[model samples]
Each structure stands twice: as structure tokens, then as C-alpha cells.
Target: MVTYTGDVTPGGAPDVRDAGGLRITKVAVDEKMSNNCYLLRCRTSGAQVLVDAAAEPDTLLPLIGEAGLTTVVTTHQHWDHHRALKAVVDATGAEVAAGFPDADAITEQTGVEVTRPVRQGDVVRVGEVSLEVITIAGHTPGSIALLYDDPEGHPHLFTGDSLFPGGVGNTFGDEAAFIQLIDEVETKVFQRLPDETWFYPGHGGDSTLGAERPHLAEWRARGW
Candidate 1:
């Protein structure tokens, strides 16, 4: 069993986590941007889902291999986050999905149609694995976080540029937006999930809710 470090570097190697039924592959891309892209593959049915084709199809497509991708989920409308989305979808013909509010912008930017304009409570399936949609607005109007509760273990969260290790995502200097992002992150994410829930961010490494819960007040005071 390979260790899941979650410390991926651009052009290095993906960090793989084999958690019973699901295999999580986290790769770094977009060069200077240092964006993170994840592949969630189900062992039983062999269905796969790509989270944020942020960049470098050469790097991403190979990771996908012959099994082919079932879906490509764009986290938000951020240009940096969807750079390779078109290429991946073109090569795999995978269905595209994103937050309903940001779906249009993602399409306009990437020119790839968002077939599934998902919202809160919606579930995305990777074969038999289920990922619940959690809209964590503020970083972007349509920013979303995907939650996967491991039936046998702890919960896993895919927070695309929303929650991070130290603080929440940047709100571009809008305190109200910062408040909204943090509040949603608090209510929908922090308050709801247990301390052990592990989260994967859009960029950088991963962290657990327990590691980050203590700094919520500090993050709020600083107003990111």
C-alpha cells in the first residue's frame, strides 16, 4: 500500500491514496500556478471522474490511461482551473459539470459545454462512488465543494479554491465575500463534518478539518 502524502509538486508524481473502494490520485499542474488536479476512480465498476483539468493534457491524459474518463468536473469559473478542460474532454468525451451559477462562465472560458450544471445536494457518481455537491460560495459565486463520506472510514472533501490549510480562499478584498465564503465553509463544511474529514484544495496540499478548525476565528479576523 502506497502512502498518501498529498504533497504533490508540478511535474513530479501524483500522490495516490487507496482507500478501499476508491483510489484518489492527486497531481500538480499549471506550472507556476501550481494548481492541483485529482482523479477519483472506483475499483468495483471502474468508473472514473476527473476533478479540475487545470492544465497540461500531456500530464493528465496519461494519468487517466485506457480506462477513459467518465466525467470532468470544473470546480468554478476560474480560468487557471479549467485550462486543460477542453483537451481532456475532447480526448475522453467525458461529461462536463460545474456549479450552476458558474457553468456559463466556465463554458465561455473553456468553450466546453457544462452538461451537468450542478448545485448543492446534487450527487456526482464515479461508478458506484458518490460525491455530494456542497456550494461554498464567495471565492466565486458558483464555487462548490464535493464531499465523499467513506462508508468504512472518514469523509473526504474536494474544495476547489475554497477552504485550505490555513485560511479560506481569497475573496479579492471583499470582506462581505470573505465572510460569505467563510460562513458557508463553516456552516456547510466545518460545522457539519467531523474533525477528521480530509480536504483536497484546488492548489497546494491537503489538510484535515481537525488541523484547520482551530484557526477559524483567526481566519475570520484576518479576513482573507
Candidate 2:
């Protein structure tokens, strides 16, 4: 069984590592063009998940180790998120998983080799915890969010560049697609979830589903 060590706000950068029945860590990396990168881990099994591996591999690796990471997960294909993937993969033997659309880019950029291509509806498990994948394709063709049920608390969301604290993730590829993705988030992920769900966004501070739900209509009214 996993225990909660509460939320620790480590000094230096915007990195956070939370340990529940499973572990969830985020390391701030300079997005080549966007924002920060987040690294998540499952403490009990040492299974690691990287939302974006952009930051310095040397600095980031130690933090991952501090959290007892074992694998990596990419949130999108932006250069910032995956720039140091090859180095990290080499060191940890950690298989990288990304959305289906970014598979080609992930393959072309970091040839270290990917273990598998994860898509919507896929569940990545570690020990007794399982992260459910929900594809939100607007910021990038293959942008995916990982959702998990906190065995000890409310459900949590690792929203990679999809939903943020105040607004939403950046849209770089398709405008219509992004708009559609926003709608999908509303009906499928957002509305369907209980109000108590806590969202761990790729950027900015965390927010609760209850607090943010009211703003969805506002985002839609403004054209999303």
C-alpha cells in the first residue's frame, strides 16, 4: 500500500514530488518554446513517468532518482519536452511512451528507442496503481493526459499541456483540433469526473475540479 507524504514544494525551479499510494513528481524543464517539463514516479515500484523531459538531463536525472523513478512518459512532441530523452533513456533503461501522433517525431529525434506507443483508453500500471490515458489533441497532434485514482484520496490528473491552472494548454498544430479537444475535455474528462478531483497540470499550480468547473462555460463562451 502507498502512503501520502503530503505535497512537498522543493526549493529551486518549479518542481514538485508527491507520494501517495503511488508517487507523482514534476521537474521543471525549459520548454524549447513552451513552458516547463514534469517528471512523475511511482514510489513503491520505482516506476517513473516524465510528462516532458526538456530540462537539463544531468540536473533532472538526480531529481528523478530522488523520487525513485523507473520509466518516462512524454506529454507531447515539442522539442522542449523531449530534448534530453535519449540521455535519460540510456541512463535508466527507461522506456519512453508518447501519444500515437508523436511516435514518428519521438522516433526521429531520440533514437534511444521507445518501449511502446500509448494512446487514448490505454492504462499504464505500476504496482497497485494504474494511470488511465485520455488523449487531448489540440496543443499537439498526440497530446495525451494521464489520469489516476488516488487510492488514499480523490482522483488526480496529470494534464500534460492540456489543461492548466487558469486557462488551457497552448495550441500549436491545429486550431480546429484544439477547439475540439477543449470540448472533449469538457464533456468527457471534466464533466464526467466528480467535483472533488484534483488536477495536476503540466504548468502552474494545482486546482480542483470543483473550483475550475464553473470556468469551463466561460472558456467556451469566449470561443475556447
Candidate 3:
């Protein structure tokens, strides 16, 4: 079964689980906002990457353990998502990466330089594991998702805040932004990936594309 732990506060622990051969850990650093930080480790070479340095560096650093962090990727430039980015980067000395358009905002907010500017189709390597970048706009112009294909299992996607379980992320009531988000999610994500592909979002519990696929029309009709 998939493992899930409570939000990481002063004394809370993180959720740890194994997906196929990759080791995945999630910590809810910002409980009020339910912001999530994920750590993905390659079982073979022990290389690891942190997806979204949400918040609470003291809580997140310990969970990283001895494997060390190879990279820290900010999925978007949202403040809540990168609150602890500078702290984590300072402690781990890991390379900071983010989408091209959002990189400047992230750097300005976190005070940590984004050394790598990733775009759609770019590949990020962590030991033996390879994560492909998929740019999804609307939620944020440079919002991006990472797709990791486990040769022996289904693919896993780390979608920042662009795609969620119930529907596409909130577009701040912008009709055009909402439409753009849905269109990008449907064409770039649902249509291209298999239904079994699992997604670890920026917050809350995880979800599979299959569980969310049937409701595409519903989400679109509601215009959220």
C-alpha cells in the first residue's frame, strides 16, 4: 500500500514509500496551506532530487538523511512553494533548477540563484533515474511537471500546482487562464500519458491520471 504521513511540523514525521524501484518521501511543510515537498531517490545509484522546497527547512532537512540531495527543483514561482528554498539550498548545496519564465521570481523570493533553467522536453538526471520536463501553462506561465518512467513500472509525474486530483489548479478566476490550463492538461498530460501514470502534486494526497481522466469533461464544463 502507498504510505502517507501527517504534516511535518515541529515534531511530525514525513510520508515515506516506495514506488516501483524509486524511493519517494513527502513532507507537508506548510500545514495551513497544505504545501508539500517531495524527495525522490534512485534506488540503484542513490542519487536523489527534491521537488518543491515548500517550507520548514528544519523539518525537511532531517528527512533527506545521508543520501544527500542532488538537485532542488521549484515547479513554479509561487511563494508558498518556495518558502524554504533558500534554506534547503544553503544546507544541501544542491543545484537549483526551475522553469525559464519563473526562474527570476523564484530567485528574487528565495535569494537562491536558479542555476539551471529547464524547459519542456528537458531531461533531469538523478543517478540512474531520468525525469523529463513538461511545461504546463495557465496556473503560472512557467509552471512545469516532471515525468519519471520506471522501466518496470508505470510513470510517475510531479505536477506542481497546475494539475490536481479534483481539477486543474485555481486560476484566480481568470477565464482565459482556466481555459488554457485545462487545454494544456488535457493535451499535454492526459492524452499523452497512460491512465496508470501516478502524480504527486504540490499539496495534499497523491492521485493517478486514470482516477482523474474520466472527469475531464466535468472539470471543463464547470470552468474551474
In model 3, the Cα lDDT at residue 27 comes to: 76
TM-score of each: 0.98, 0.83, 0.94
In candidate 1, stretches whose alpha carbon ends up further than 4 angstroms from where it belongs are none
Residue by residue across 1-224, what tens digits does model 2's lDDT show? 44432232323454444647665655455433434556555666666666667657876778776544455788887776777888877777777788888888877877745577888899877655788888887778888888887777788887877887666776655568668878878876787788888777655567778888888878766654
Please give the range of 10 consecutive residues that has the lowest summed lDDT in model 3: 2-11
In TM-score terms, candidate 2 sits at 0.83
lDDT of 1 by residue, 45-137 (tens): 989999999999999999999999999999999999999999999999999989999999999998899999999999999999999999989
Q: Local distance difference test, per candidate?
A: 0.94, 0.70, 0.87
- CA RMSD, predictions in order: 0.7, 3.8, 2.0
lDDT of 3 at 3: 47
Between 1 and 3, whose lDDT is larger? 1
Model 3 over residues 1-224: C-alpha lDDT tens digits?
Answer: 64453234423567787766688877777558878788989888888899998888888788787778989999999999998888888888899889999999988988899999999999988888889999998999889999988788889899999988899998999999999999999999999999899888887778899999999999999999
